[model samples]
Target: MSEQVIAAIDGSEFSEGVCDYAAWASLALNAPLCFVHVLDNHSAAPSEQDLSGNLHFGAREHLMEELSALDEQRAKVNREQGKLMLEAAQKRTKAKDISDSTTRQLNGTLVETLVALEKDIRLLVVGKRGETAHQASGHLGANLERVVREMHRPILMVPATFKRPEKVLIAFDGSKTARKGVEMLARSPLFAGSECHVLIVGAETAENHSQLDWALDNLREAGHQAEGAIRAGDVDEALQAYVQEHGIDLLVMGAYGHSRIRHLLVGSTTTAMLRGSHIPVLILR
Candidate 1:
């Protein structure tokens, strides 16, 4: 990993958010920024079979040539558009004083490209929805879950706009993976000055209390203004309510905590929270 913050950009409203947030993260973590635009290759491999069965040989060859020319033109146009988008995004990042930021435009599936480039990516920023996600209000990006599952890195999911985060919320469930997320937060400087509130949504069992205490103490010892609490209710509902009540600006959680928080991503809890949250969500693996 070379400390490169990769922002997955597309021709969607969320791309602007991704660009701005990526710039913020680059500044926060003192990392280089790379804006990558992966073309949506709704895709079929080319076939070299001859088409002379239905028409005369000459006519078939002419048709094939015409089709090949059209394909080439379409591909060129798509690549040019991708290039323009990358340049414009890089130019916009200058407003954040990101003059040295770089860009990359890929011609493949988004998730695969990101995963292929994962080794050098310190942090990945992306939008919740893609450009074609015009079906419903909160339609998720098609690659969201796949990226979470395939990539072994932190992902910052954002809306169509960017916000300067002040208060942060960490959803802890006492699972080993959740504790690992807590440790990552405690060690990260991305939210150095922000207030972190850790909460566990479960019965106030002795174990739960101990888990919460351990999380809070860890964060506190790491020099964070950490606060923790335990709430009872549906995990998503309780988390959404807490986020709103506390005016949390960023929501952080583990991608999938095996023991108590496995449902977070494997189930619907993580999706629900991601859909409900208006603030940025930092997902740790």
Candidate 2:
């Protein structure tokens, strides 16, 4: 089977957007699209239960049986709900002209399920927030952050709404990690036709200028219509400003890189760009 662009949907408000973006990637890469909905099995542990054995023998057995039945019932409902979500995701992809897309309904933690299928994944698409997440929380759903950190394949983390991208931004910081992002874009057809911008948020030092020139040259050589600039400000502030002023539809970056740009993914202001920006993020490993 061909490597698949997998979109992890969970019937959340962001599910539709995930489908749309995944469809775009599937078409661009000429890969199969698979919609996956994993049943999150994060239930209360046995340790958290009332296991004091304070009741009579028959009462203890009855309580254990009741709990088991309840758990079974909940899993049953989740299975049916996941099936419907997969079907809806398939419909959405079909409407995008991806008639041959597939879906999988799995019972396990999302992270482990995706990791097991890692060998077959060309790209993974997921929503920033999950069904249980609240918009007012102002934080990324825990699963999203963990997946980005652990998954080996490139990931496309989408927002609650999506628009076909017209412009793309690379949050380059002259780090090896950031350079890897440039290489990923140059090799993939996903951003082949979109206008690309390489923005370095810092002083326009001679070294910074050299780094920008190197990026532009590499992208140009790879047949991408790319340009570069060095702006002065904090990494978070400058990036946010440039995105708004330039109408960037997608933001690309390398995770675990160096400096403030690096901090944007793993530092105190981890969500500075991923959560702050209104566009989808393409995180290259």
Candidate 3:
């Protein structure tokens, strides 16, 4: 019953990177890895259309039966495709020296499946852009935003390519979720040897400084080489600028907070950061 890193694969160009990143996570965290490919039934369902305009009642019934058979056949084909995708992902993970891995093909939405498996999931690894998103071009994955919002576990979103991160940035805002994120970095092996930077956006208040100091102390005490700084201006812009300026390979942050509420009300800095970030994002709950 050990916690597992669940990597969602869609057989896209991003799938290989997802597997690679998940393998790194599994090694770092000493956790088992599971590859999950969801065969989205809703998306695969055949559209209903009326074709009785030129048919008798009996003929219409026959057509309906044929359509039903076609739908069944399509579902079967999709299931086989999903299985092949999972097998390929498993092979890739095993090649990364992660032999203690498993693969599953579920029949539902990806977010829903992850939520159902939340308790056993140590971390969820997914692609920044899924198969559909990649095809659409410039659009974020349909499930990325929703998964971050709905799941209560950590999610590691891998970009198109995988790079072993050497520097890590934690976006701290003094929120409970942010504090939890700090605790995770201190306790987990995920960022073990990476140079850690804690950045707080906005005017430097005593409270904010104190919080950053406390976080840095915690990380330093945990054997992490940690540093802290305060930046002024827009949160997302400041974050993006800092990453660009500092050569950050990974960005860690709480996925939602008052910022998420703002996203609901107006726009979300969290969403913007996710959309605009050039590196992989480790989103804590």
Candidate 4:
């Protein structure tokens, strides 16, 4: 069976860009693609409710009219608009020869929809902005970081503006997470024949150097040609400079290192990298 890439999309332009990236990866890996749209129930609930259900007949009739008016005014886009957007998204996928695609409109929370579909999905692509974008108040969408922690699948968090990555940088620290990342590169056709740069930061001792060497051997053994180098500095700064200098297309790294709490408070180097890197990030946990 072909691998499956699940891209969560809304009708925005950013969602369309995410679909394009998902199509590229799906085609490269020979996988099927699915476009998903989740409607937040909180965003769709009726603005006003009638007390008519419990009121006297005369007052009930008056309140019923008010409720009906409120509901009519609250109606944003009808079901027909949703269908058209979904059809257009599916057509975009078909144009790229990814004809075997499905579009879904989900009700309830995005996290719930994602958690339910996590098992069969190989990659999850999401647009950074949503209808809630302007209201985000400088946060990275509420359920996003949570999904990254909970979902076992790899997540490609696409920025508002994106370009296909030509070369990728893998942040290797010789951890189990890093090893899994190497495995992803080997099995994924997206990184096949592309320049894979193995960056090892914070190697201060002999044991650290030995560990770095072992990690390099693993990548080479996996048939992904890679070059390794050790830099002396904070992980975030070193990675940023490396990407800027080399014109790196993507940055692959483990999600959390020591602990989630510590990472959240002080912020892990990986988290810091995400804030400043500006490139698409593939985060594995």
Please give each candidate's TM-score.
0.89, 0.91, 0.91, 0.81
Model 1 TM-score (2 dp)? 0.89
lDDT of 2 by residue, 1-285 (tens): 678999999967889899999999999999999999898755432444676467866887787888788778888888899999999888878888999988898878888899988999999999888787745457776777778767888889898787988788898888877787887777778987777889998887999999999888888888878876899977778888888888889988776445676566766435667776678988777
Backbone-clash count (model 4): 0
Error of 4 at 176 (Å): 2.3
- Residue 130 deviation, candidate 2, in Å? 1.3
Model 2, which residues run further than 4 Å from truth? Answer: 44-47, 51-57, 135-137
Number of the top lDDT candidate: 1
Error of 2 at 254 (Å): 0.3
Predicted structure 3: lDDT: 0.82
Top candidate on TM-score is: 3
- Model 4 lDDT tens row, 1-285: 344798887755567778788888888877788887776646665655546576766996777678677656544353455667778878988888888788777766788889898876888887655546635434565567667667877888777665778778887776766666777775678887777777777747786677667766766776766776778777778888899888888888775467332263234222556655567877776
For model 4 the local lDDT of residue 15 reads: 71
Model 1 lDDT on a 0 to 1 scale? 0.83
Report every candidate's CA lDDT: 0.83, 0.82, 0.82, 0.71
Clashing pairs counted in every model: 0, 0, 0, 0
Candidates 1 and 2 compared: the better one by lDDT is 1
Residue 61 Cα positional deviation in candidate 4, in Å, after optimal superposition = 8.5
lDDT tens string, model 1, 246-275? Answer: 999999877564544455655542367776
